[model samples]
Target: MQAVILAAGKCTRFWPLNEKHKSLFRIMGRPLISFCLENLKRAGLKEVIIVQGKKRDIENELKKEKISGLKIRYVIQEKPLGTGHALKTAYSYLKEKILVLNGDDYYGAQEFKKVLSFFPSILVKEEKDPTSFGVIVPQKNYVKEIAEKSKKPPSNLVNAGCYFIPKSILKEKIKKSSRREYEITDYLRKLAKKEKLAFFKAKEWSPLSYCWNLFDIKEILIKSLKREIKGIVESNCQIKGRVFVEQGTIIKSSSHIEGPVYIGKNCQIGPNCCIKPGSVIGDNCRVGQAVEIKNTILGANNKVSHLSYLGDSIVEEGANLGAGTIIANLRFDKEKIKTVVNGKIVETKRKKFGSVFGKGVQTGINVSIMPGVLIGREAVIGPHTLVKENIKEGTAFYSHFAGFKKEKKRI
Candidate 1:
């Protein structure tokens, strides 16, 4: 059996998260898609086909982590088509049974094993929002109807987007979906007419559709890190609990690090900083003096200087937060925060949703970003600004209360 990893989606919903592909984002110091590839290899899969776009970042990373036995093949998703079109592009090598999945989401190994055992089947899961996903109405134990975003869904069992299809089924013509793209769900709709599509329940799943979705599994994954130290630690640094410090990371003096935390490679933790549980600092990151990072995932090369409070947010790579930059993760009313993804308001279901900054973005000193605000890619927030809403890409926003006061004096 072969696995087709669909890594070609441009991930436009994740604005300010860089133009690079989403699968290339690292988790615990490893590329996200590599985890899926590694699992496929571990499951005795030899031929793994990864469909990528023109972006070479994902392709380069795959070359860096070359496995011995797996025959890695890269196919280009030429145009911005739907998932069904992507599968059609890789049809030449898809022999026997094929396992298909999205690259950004992680489908667990055990679930993959179950799907593999029940080949030529579709996997479904019970979700809270059935309309937000492709839903499957089941009859007895088999899939009866696969509906694409039913406003009134018959059942909560959603299509998890993991399909186990035989080579014979790949020949059907997938109709163009209402979204103006070829969809695999169209074929599955046809498949349900004749064959009883075997349904398997998905135990674990997560979709990376928006910025705050990064925090969905934060606490669970941070604790699962291997508590081993490979980095240099100063004698004055206080380290406690189950902390996993990857290679090239350094803990400076008087910095208190509590466990259930993962510090990635080449990171520098401060002289007088405090890092609490559920903190995942990525590679080459810097946490400076009097700073506190709690239950946050800082992407690579992010620098949080002195007198800052960063909590419960996903800061993308190459972002810089200046001194006294306090990210307001919680609302004054203490309600769950929401964000706009693809022009739709999505309730994050998390109270703590700090600002999400894109790559190479900078925040000036004393910046206060309100809870759940999204700053776009390459955008800059001027010093002392109180950001209340989303910032568009490549723009700079500055809040000037002093200027307003000066004008009032003239009036």
Candidate 2:
């Protein structure tokens, strides 16, 4: 049996962070697709088919990794259609039995095993908000009916985008959806009427559909990491709990770490720095003196040097945070932080959500950013500025907010 990984997504939501496909987005020093493939590897399946678009960014990485003799194949989806159309593109490479999965999602081994246990089943899980997803109607462990967004769903069980299907599905006629795209759920719903579609309820599913999903995914990845200190720990350093310090990483004097935290290869963590739990600092990064990083995901080569506090944030690759910079994770009201995505207020559903800085972003000294803000790629944030809104990609901002005693223009 083989697997079909759907990766050809025309992504726009993961802005600044993704100039390319979302599958190529790095998480914990690995691309998002890497985790999915790793889960497939853990599930004991070797042969694979990946459907991607023009760039083939994922293909390049997979080839470079050379995943230990893993037989891999790729198909280009010229048109940016829905999942149903993507699966159709892999018709030439389909096997007698295949597991169809989303490429950007990171599912655990236990759930994949459950889906594989049933050859003709669809993996599903109970979601809190089923209206936004394809809801499943189960009857005696088999899928009775599948509905996409009803006023009232039959059940809370939603599609986790993992399916066990025959190769003959490629021959089925799929009609275009109302949105002018072909959806796999519609095809599966129709398929359920004529054939057997078993259902397996999964216990864990971590989807990377939005930016906020990274926080939970990062925490899950960090927690499962084993403790290994491959780097140098200087004197007067306090290491509590399990921490994975990769090779060439050096923790200087007077730094304290509370783990399940990870420091990637060649990282330079400094003196008087406090790295709290659930933090993952990537390769060649620098965390300088008097800095505190709490549960933040600092990408490779980022520099947060001196007197900075990063809490529950995501700083992409090659970012530079100047001294005395602070990213506030909590709102004054303490309510769930909401970010405006494409002029729509999308709730992050996080009470302690910090800002997301894209690749190569630079900040001047003493910059302060509000919660749920997004700074674009290669953007420049000037000194003593207060960021209250999103910054566009490749833009430079130098605005500051200060209340004047009288009616006057503020910085």
TM-score of each: 0.93, 0.95
lDDT of 2 by residue, 382-401 (tens): 99999999999989999756
Q: Candidate 2, after superposition: displacement of residue 375 in Å?
A: 1.1
Q: Which residue pairs in candidate 1 collide? A: 16-377
Candidate 1 lDDT at 376 equals 80
Error of 1 at 267 (Å): 2.0
What would the TM-score be for candidate 2 when compared with the true structure? Answer: 0.95
In TM-score terms, candidate 1 sits at 0.93
Clashes of 1: 1
Candidate 2, pairs of clashing residues: none
Report the number of the highest-lDDT candidate.
2
